[model samples]
Target: MTTLVKLDHVTRRFGDITALDDVSLEIDSGRIVGLLGPNGAGKTTLLSLVQGLRRASSGTVELFGGSPADARTRRHLGCTPQETALPPTLRVGEVIDFVGAHFDNAVPREELAAEFGISELLKRQTGALSGGQKRRLSVALAFVGRPRLVLLDEPTTGLDVDGRRALWAAVHRQQDAGATVVVTSHYLEEIEALAERVIVIGQGRVLVDDDLSAVLDQVGLRLLRLTTPTPDRVRALTGVVDSRPEHDGSFTFFVQDADVAVAELVRSGIQFSGLTVRGATLEEAFLTLIADSPKQNDAAGVSPRGI
Candidate 1:
């Protein structure tokens, strides 16, 4: 696959703070990439650089094999920020129609409005729409140009479960049409469902970048819950990394190998009603990675401006 976006030794600083430090990354065409991090971890800064909204203090940012500022390159990109920027007095349809005018080839106004279930809202002013409705309209406006690269910052923020599913369907439609999407979201489950690759950032630097499954395997720890009367005895097992007793005579043990630990528990003749093995989810893996890193302390104080 060809590289759609590239950042080389990118550094952005403000006075005593460093928003991005020697960050280098490459995003390929036709893939959904999840850009994840806790607050102030530079996810938004990176996206801004890609959109040419802010320039790197040093180093370079490239889009479609050219500088991000190039008109031809920028025409292929679209962005939806975390906060909506529509004119409050303008009707929903008017906002999209205004933005659509900037693009050489835009999705038909009727078709785009219908796809997001906002055709009825075309006459409603932006301020009159509900939170979820506003979010849907914001998302629809972002895709009006049908650009090859789309950047979404917390796209599903105000959506309910049903609305989230609807947004996901639209995202899938974009992917089918060959668009590369880079999304920043705090919702790990949504990211897992939409992204093939996950990029974790910490302290203004890239911490992990790989296939979502591979990253999970590397960072995910397993837990074994054994329902036994004698919780203290279960805790004494050799392979038990950590154990916590539940109120109902059961103990949950964090372990490296569930198979090896379960066999030992059986061999010891421990009386148990049941046993359940649980794998770490993307959320757990992400939290564990941040908690274990020393840089997490530093990440708390830094904030990127104009995100």
Candidate 2:
């Protein structure tokens, strides 16, 4: 696949603050990438540099094999920022037409609106639209130019469950039609649902970058829940990562393998009940990554509250 964007040891700073560290990455063509991070993790700064909204303090940022700040690069780059400022007087269809006019090969206004589930809102003025409606329109506008690379920052910010699903479907359609998309969100479910590849960012650095499955596997955290009299015994067992005592006389054990842990529990004759074993979710994997990056957190002055 082609390389649509590449950052070579890039660093961006605001006078005294370094928003992005010496980071390097590559986004290839046709990949759905999720940029996951907590507040002040430099997610927005990284996207801004890519969109040519800001220049890197040092190093290089390239789009289509050229500087991201170039007109040609901007032409092929479409971005929907977290906060959108649309012309209040412009009707939805008019906004679409106006944006589409900038590109030589734009998706038809009606088609774009319908794909994003905003067909009925075509005639409504931007100012009169609800928060969710405006959000949908903002995301749809990114595809008005038939962009090859689209950056969506919190695209489903104010959307309900159904609306969010519709937006996800629209994004899937865009990816299927050959658009490389990068989405950043506070919602882990959105990232898990939309991203094939996941990048975990923390303290202005890339903590984890891999296939979504690989990330979860790397953490290798499984949970075994059971009512036990002695939580310390469970914690001391080999292969058990950690054990926490719950209020209801149950212990939750983090383990590498659930079956092995259960076998050990049975072999020890530990008098346990209400056994339940389950795999870790993305949230658990994320917490594991953060816990392992204490040095990075310190250097970046990141307190637990920051996350």
Candidate 3:
């Protein structure tokens, strides 16, 4: 795949605070990459640099081999910011046409609207639309130009399950049509459903970057829930990362291999019941990654909050 965007040792600062710290990564064309992090993790700042909304304090940022700040470079980019303020009085079709005017080869207005499931509301005024409709329209506008690269920052902030799935389908179609997409979202399930690669950031720095399967394998986690009185012994078993007690005399153990842990429990005569083992969710894998990430110390040797 062709490299669409590149950042080398990039750092962004606001006043006395650093928002991104010595970050380096590349987005390849034709891939849907998921950016995962907690609140204030500098995910937004990173996207801003790529969108040319903010300048990097140090190092380099390249969009399609040109400076992101250049209009020529930005022309091939489409973005849906976290907050969207559309002209309320304009009809939905008019609003779509307004955004399409910026690109010389814009997608047909009606086709674009239909692709995003807004064809029925094209005649409705923007102000009269529901929250979900507004959100979908905000996202659909990003594809109006048929951009080569799309950056979506929490695109489904206020949508029901069906709405979210509809948006996801539109994104998949975009990728299938040869668009590279970078999605920054708090929803783990969204990432799991949309991304082929996952990048995790913490404390304003890159914590994990790999294929989705490899990221899950990096932690090799399995959630084991059971009833056991000897929590200490359960925790001491090999392959067990940690264990926590529940109110109903149950324990949830983070383990590498449920079979190994269970076998060990039986062989050692450790008392356990109500045993159940399940695969880790993307959220569980993400939490484990950030928890084990080393905090980057600042000039004063203090750990600062993620920007």
Candidate 4:
């Protein structure tokens, strides 16, 4: 596969606050990659570098084998930032037409609107649209150009459940149509839904980069929640990573093997009630990684910045 985006020894700083550090990464053509991180963890900074909204302080960033800032490179790219600025007085149809006019291969206005479930809002003035409507419109605009690479930064930020699901469907359709997409969102379920590959960043450095299943395996942990008379005994159970007493006298245990923990509980004759076991979520994995190593710089030989 051709490499659509490349960051080589890249770094970006904002007056000594390292937004991205010693980072090197590549995004190949036609992949759905999720970018996850906490606030100020450099997710926005990385997307900015890719979109050519900002220059990297050091290192190299390339899009389609050309500088990201090049007009030729940008012509094939589409981006929906966390916030969008739309012409208040413009009707939805007019706004679509304006952006669509920029690309030779733009998708037809009617078709794009239909696909995004915003066709009915075509006659409405952008200013009168609700927040969710505006969000859907902003995301739809990204695809108006029939872009080969799409960057969606918190694309569903203000969207309701139905709106978010519609956007996810649109993203899936884009990927199926052969666009390489990079998405950043605080919602882990969104990432889980749309991304095949996952890149987890923390404190401006990459903590994990792998296929979604592999990344989850690396964070292999189960949570066991139950009510026990002896909370301390649960903490001492084998394979238990940690235990926390809930407000209602229940205890939650982080365990490497839930089955083993349960067996131990049985052998100890512990009368645990309301036993529940669930797999760890992406959010849990992300938090664990951050908690384990909140602020570690990259290796000395690397540079920084990404998306």
Each model's Cα RMSD: 5.5, 4.1, 4.8, 5.8
Off by over 4 Å in 2: 225-253, 259-276, 295-307
Model 4 lowest lDDT segment of ten: 298-307
- What ordering of candidates by TM-score runs from best to worst? 3, 4, 2, 1
For 1-307, candidate 4 gives per-residue lDDT tens digits of 8899999988999997999998999999867999998778899999899988899999999988899888778888998733358888999999999988889889998999999998899999998988998999999888888888999989998788988998999899988998889999888889999999999998888889999899989888899999977878887878887555566778777788888989998999977899999987776656657655624322211212121
Q: TM-score per candidate, in order? A: 0.81, 0.83, 0.87, 0.85
Off by over 4 Å in 1: 224-255, 258-277, 295-307
**Model 2 lowest lDDT segment of ten:** 298-307
lDDT of 1 by residue, 216-284 (tens): 888767778878778777778876755555566676676668888888888999898778999855654
Model 3 lDDT tens row, 211-303: 988887886789899998788888888988755565677887888888998898899898888988998776666565565644521211222
Better of 1 and 3 by lDDT: 3
Q: Whole-model lDDT, candidate 4? A: 0.84
Which regions of candidate 3 fall more than 4 Å away from where they truly are?
229-233, 244-249, 266-271, 294-307
